[model samples]
Target chain A: MGELEKIREARKKWQEKYEKSCTERDALFQSISGVPVKPLYTPEDAEGLDYLRDLGLPGEYPFTRGVRQNMYRGRLWTMRLFSGLGTAMDSNRRYHFLLDHGTTGLSVAFHMPTIMGVDSDNPRARGEVGRCGVAIDSLEDMEVLFDGIPLEKVSTSMTINAPAAILLALYIGVAEKQGVGPDKITGTIQNDILKEYIAQKSWIFPPEPSMRIITDILAFCSEHVPRWNTISISGYHIREAGSTAAQELAFTLADGLAYVEAGVKAGLDVDAFAPRLSFFFDAHLDFFEEIAKFRAARRIWAREMKERFKAKKTESLLLRFHTQTAGCSLTAQQPENNIVRTAFEALSGVLGGTQSLHTNSMDETLALPSEKAAQIALRTQQIIAFESGAADTIDPLAGSYYVESLTDRLEKQAYEYFERIEKLGGVVKAIERGFFQKEISDAAYRYQKEIEQKKRIIVGVNDYVVENEKVEIPVLVIDPEVERIQVARVKALREKRDNDAVKRRLEELKKAAAGSENLMAPILEASRAYATLGEIVDVLKSVFGEFKEIPVF
Target chain B: MERKVRVLVGKPGLDGHDRGAKVVASALRDAGMEVIYTGLHQTPEMIVEAAVQEDVDVVGLSILSGAHMALFPRVLELLKEKGVDDVLVTGGGIIPESDMEKLGKLGVGKLFGPGAPTGEIADYIREWFKSSSRAKG
Candidate 1:
């Protein structure tokens, strides 16, 4: 008899073996994704699944076990802290601090204005010049952001969408000044605009023009910047926008499929751009579920890329991703508990075989992370990596009954979502009809309702309630003068630069935006001329028009 | 006959972090308030115009980019320009305690912070209606 049949025979004695063993009280009895958890998962659960076909060796087909053979034994996952707040100088200082303290990579969080393609002095950007992240108004701001750092040596990921193309142009212009070639500069642009329409909502142009810009970057990057990841198709914001883990997995992969289809239809070879594609997933508070999510994400991507897209490249089938601990999981009442919460989420990312990870600062729930809090968050990852022995093995939870069951369950649910989205005429058309937004809103509402009704126990929130809580953690305050300084600095840059050259470059960009020319070359020219982000975006807005979201609630 | 509370939830300026705003909008609607959410990138003028045209009883501006200081006052000024005095201009975000006090003195109503219960926000609006409308009558 098979091992499953043997376990089933033993399972028949559950009343004698387990049920009478202990009396249980109220338990949640389910995963956060609403998957029911059984008291025990035996070999009978994994019954008809073939080992080699379903779970191959590391770095092989259907990479469910692990992405690389050696995994962290060969090298640890990149410790990338999402650092940036205040002026370019302040953000630059933080970057230096993180790098000095042994962070392997850098992730930039652009300010609200910069992310939305607005300049520092714009009326809409008055008190928000450098609030959330580094304020990169022009190439000058980007220059100060990377003043002493070597462009080719350290990989950097900039978290900016809607205006990702312009930011990439500025970074390339800076690398050119450093004499670093495009191929040598490696990083990613969170150039996932479909998610913008679906979740984040900082989109500039309508979907059609936005997809055009994405394909243009794919074409340009494949030829020139081979190492640069043109897009990090994100589910981070989707989860933040109120998706369950399964929904986050499904919608993000669906968006990735949309980008692949877009690239192919743009007359580009799937292999050329697909090999450079990457993913970004969020690690919520769910421990085993997150690990299962990362595992299931890999298997689905590998199978679909091979069978569905029929891509011929090995690298094209890998679903390498970056994981950031969930910001939504942090609560302001007992902010310090966030440290413990973040550490577990980070460990899940490691066990899930993330290519890179960013553990959120404890103080993020209140404001931008304080410097000490940022250090603590970094140390959380380091301790897990070095001391805990988590990174010592590959797929340590592979044979676990519960984990494997959850992985299969999540993969099945994701396919159901894909079918639903395809029936609604794929992601773009589904988005146009407010399908993604409504689904996310419903999930978010349900989660909040669960908390309100005390169905879910959030330790600091509803369970161990604290009244009149005094949160004594240091909050990083961005000096109001930073705004005045950034505004004046951008105005000075405008006056100092050659007005004629700036005008000519912007006009050339506008012409390119209107015509069928690839936008990168002209945008790079404008960046070299020190044209501001708002100026460059205004040129495109004139031709492409700004996108106003269709409100969904 | 009783009237439904009408609240206009607006995200002014370039801050696109609307999770709080959207969640609050849904909660208010669930609480039986008519909600008009002006989806992202609305200028102060556009937001006030929508509030006035919709004839909302309350205008809740949600901002997290630390731009509340510049934005809240401008919305108040625009409402004054249109002489919409009866409309309440309450707000919330990651505003510092000091800034929250400053906004209160500038004629904005109570400001909520992160993790402030949605039920509390709904109750505050309901409480405001009883006192203010009763006074007008």
Candidate 2:
């Protein structure tokens, strides 16, 4: 009490001095989620917050500090650079480069042709082969994608959701070629299709079928690929789609909770599969706000996993996430300024103790990052980890009056969102009724209005007087011939494979998809038989049918 | 007769990121146009056929997969082959400058880069049709 009184007196003295200087400064100092700022925190702030219950020791229950006890001290977070562009071989070269340059893991990004379940030669897949990311038309392209990379030793993350089961099957098939059984491989698939519907909108089938496909992967992976994360419930794209940090946190956790309920409903034990359930958060430009968001996300997810779902294992309560710098924050105008923006975002992720980080290139808002830009982006992380002293401490701002208060506030606000969502009949109903969509739309509209009104000043965009700063960095340009080369490769591979065998596999896939049988096995067999993405998707499309977007506005 | 300017907005290939396509659909609809957003993952054949079946005057393809170089020309070639010449074709997403130029040459009416205002795009569509109409008359 004496120590608390002394601290309170000191805080009161400073607050009185500061309050005299600026009348509204105290209130204005609050975090962006509209949480209030407090002058000082005593034990009173953490009242009833049992150490074991609220902020458990790292690697223990609740996992408030982190998933691992030693954290980065045990092993540095995976420095995975999410990159893929221009043909499989080209992306393969980049993968080798990233690994050579000390990337701990590989996160493969696919081109649209591959993402949409189309082969390169498909008329719709034209011009797009190997553009944004690597194009994997069949198991052949997947093989080229991992040409020399060891499947057994190195972990891989594929950012494919709509075709996640298909892609996972392809990767496992690739591993099989490398003589590594599915059990030996370690990686994650961004198989969180619900977020795809609510935010990213890259969904293949309707929600029911999509959830079924995801559960099938979860069921299969739990039995076989125990080390692999079946689904990386992502808030990255949600934030990029114009959600506030609080919305990202709430929506992502809600999606995760929904997934747990889905797994449980699908006749799987929560502890068995919940251990592999991971999260992906977006590290936006708001430094302290982003950090608060991450901390709050961890606390909320832990509480929900334990209290709501009654998850027993410590792993079930832990929210291990990978952070990607916000691509939406980068501006095409004065694009070079994006470097600083990305640096701040990366620092936020680091300070928040992310398990893995991917920083965006300055030129990303312009086109896919060129080699020089990608290198610069990677070097940003390197400089932050090595040169910057930020990483020396875990949760560096843990006890900050502002950060802790905001973390608590964000956790509270997210619960409010969960309650509101529950009232609106949970995430699925909210999505169907366009509640989440409308809320995000309103938030996006508000943010845009603020920017336009100069209420929110983006340095080069508004307030800062950079008139005509020429972007000097070399933008990576993919050769037009890459498309020709990719198309030819798909054509050649299709011709070389056993046509009848492929057809049989495709028919089996259609049959399995049409029926109640798990689609993953047949899809894997199809991939093994050299079935193209278009061929496989066509089978599903014929059976499950295409998704027709309903106008919500 | 005032023919409705029906636009088919599509995201082709495997990239399921459709924020742009959805936003543009909303904007176009707000601008007094009928927008058919053929959700994520449409094939070129599928998109072209939708355009024809819906009798859309514009087919806007929003591709974030960077597969435009491979897929855009094929869509255009398919549209031309299907004898759908009067359709105002456009594409958007993360397109490099060189690729944008190449796509324009291939009869993609416009390439809308990031941060290009929706109002500006709507205006461009209006102006393009006006000039074309004038030239024909």
For residues A1-553, could you state the per-residue lDDT of candidate 2 as single tens digits? Answer: 6866777778778878978885552223434443444655665455445556666676766666777888876777888999898888899999998888888899998876676677778776656667678878889988989988899999999999888998999999999999999999999999998887788777677788888888899999999889999999999988888788889999999999999999999999999999998889999877888898888888888888888889898888889999999998888777888989999899999888899999998998777788778888889999998889877766777766666666777788899999999999888888888787777766665565456555566766656746755567787777778888988998898889999999999989888887888788899999999998888888888887766566453
Q: In model 2, what is the error at residue A136, expressed in angstroms?
A: 0.4
What lDDT, from 0 to 1, does candidate 2 have? 0.82
| Candidate 1 lDDT over residue span B1-137, tens digit each | 55788899999988777888888999999998899999888899999999989988899999888788889999999999998888889978887777888989999999998677789899999889867753354
Model 1: how far is A453 from its true place, Å? Answer: 0.5
| Highest-scoring model, DockQ | 1
User: For each candidate, what is the lDDT?
Assistant: 0.90, 0.82
| Tens-digit lDDT track of model 2 for B102-133 | 88887788889776667777887767766664
- TM-score of every candidate relative to the true structure: 0.97, 0.87
Instruction: Score residue A355 of candidate 2 by CA lDDT.
Output: 94
